[model samples]
Target: MKKLLLAGVTIAMMATPAIAQTYKFAVVPKAMNNPFFDVARDGCLKRAKELGNVECIYKGPIEHEPATQAQIIQDFITQKVDGLAISVADVASMTKSIEAATAAGIPVITFDADAPGSKRIAYIGTNNKDFGLALGKQLLQLRPEGGKYAMVSGGPGAKNLAERVDGVREALKGSKWVEVQGSPTFCNDDSTLAVQQMSDLRTATPDLAAIVPVGGWPMFAPEGFKAFVNKNKKDIDSGKLTLVVADTLKMQLELLRDGYSNALTGQRPFEMGEKSMDTLLAIKKGQKVPEVIYTGLDLVTKDNVAQLLK
Candidate 1:
């Protein structure tokens, strides 16, 4: 009996730390193949290593959609994840699943995009309004004489992109010369596809003064928009089309420097991952985190582009 009790105690001791072992967190983006979210995933993984024993799982659909994100969010809940995050592709479509995750007691942080009314605890991404306002301010600087400019973006239903697109329009409102003429084209987060779409739009509009690709991915670099520019470099050079990208993607900086992008609006990818882990660890440690943590953004221009780019 004495030996058995000692054996039982030993087993308990072994089980304690195992039970206390760090749990899994999930990072779900709009799509599994997107290079943009992969950067954020890269940051999350890098930071996950520093935390030791904590695991960060990344999953998403083939295409960027709210339903797929919701499904991934539900899977996290079913798997009993410690935390979950999403760069919402569609806001309204994700509401129920986000609520489901909340019901399961797993806190969720929205990245890249957000659902303002959802049960999500916080967002760890660019400030959309600031992104918009900054773009507005930048547009005036770029074309002080303000002429007809068109906007290209992702889905019209996308919350974050819409904010930036709207902000650009608002900024150009005061400039009588800067008319936003062309119909807004969708970027869909695929550089190749975006290029093709932009090319078609450019072909249709005879006087598309400037192209504003709001946010990361398509607008960030011309190579990403090559479907249009690759065939018409002369047009881009002749001043018929000037491309304005949203955020600076690290790997795409070379393309930007090579003249594919006029400038890029940059977001803090590494810090986003680090901050996200910090938030989860804080919650695990019985600490309270804020409902909103606004990770700001910056603009990258030809002048100081090499500073961070290199």
Candidate 2:
């Protein structure tokens, strides 16, 4: 009887499935202060909980500093994380760190912003050039007989923003719209500086017909952006000046409804975060994955802002 009982216990143990290995996936965003990235962080955490074996470590510089961001990546590599997903702050700087991680036998992927020259396994984010084209087209639709416009971008070294700028230019090619001299002022991800630059650009070029921000930097600061919009209310209402900014955050949507912006082009940062983990897990399991995974974009205007809010 004792021998039969022992045999039954051994069979039961053998039939039970072994626990899966837990993966520690780190998601490095451009900055921790940006509310836009907060959504991404939520997505990462949600997906990690769903997976039950993925530990998502979301960390980055307090602000948009390439050097600081690179240091964070180095620290993660030293910690020997199972996989890494980064939104590249500076393409060149991030590429070096990504290559080092790959050499260390760790899988690496990029999201939000990409470093195409790097040895990273895959990129999961928006096709920024297309995002820019959409921004330009939105502006054109608002003020089709374009006059003068200036672009506002986050970081000067950001590959994503540069592509969007180029795309906007491409979309405006042969159109009446002309980019103002000394346009595309870089705010370096500072919301205050972004609003100031907008004011300064408008002051410098009185005939500036449109202001296109490839990213919604100023919109992050609701009161300040509201004040700026209120100051420019006459122009915006008269259609003499148009504002087409990127991202459809809650605050941005509110501003759009309040007539602060003409149009908005949004990226799915949350989806980027969720998919970053999914892609990294597949790579860790040696499964096939695509080189580029575009999360898609949202073009928001007064027409859809109400429904999106709900």
Q: List TM-scores for all candidates, in order.
A: 0.87, 0.95
- Stretches of model 1 off by over 4 angstroms after superposition: 1-20, 177-182, 219-227
What lDDT would each prediction earn against the true structure? 0.73, 0.92
Worst 10 residues of 1 by lDDT: 10-19
Top-scoring candidate (TM-score):
2
The CA-based lDDT of model 1 is what? 0.73
Task: Compose the digit string of candidate 1's lDDT tens values, residues 105-140.
Answer: 887778778888998877888888678767766767
Reference-based lDDT, residue 139, model 1 = 60
For model 1, name the residue pairs that clash.
Answer: 146-177, 146-178, 153-187, 219-245, 246-265, 247-265
Could you tally the backbone clashes for each prediction? Answer: 6, 0
Clashing pairs in 2: none
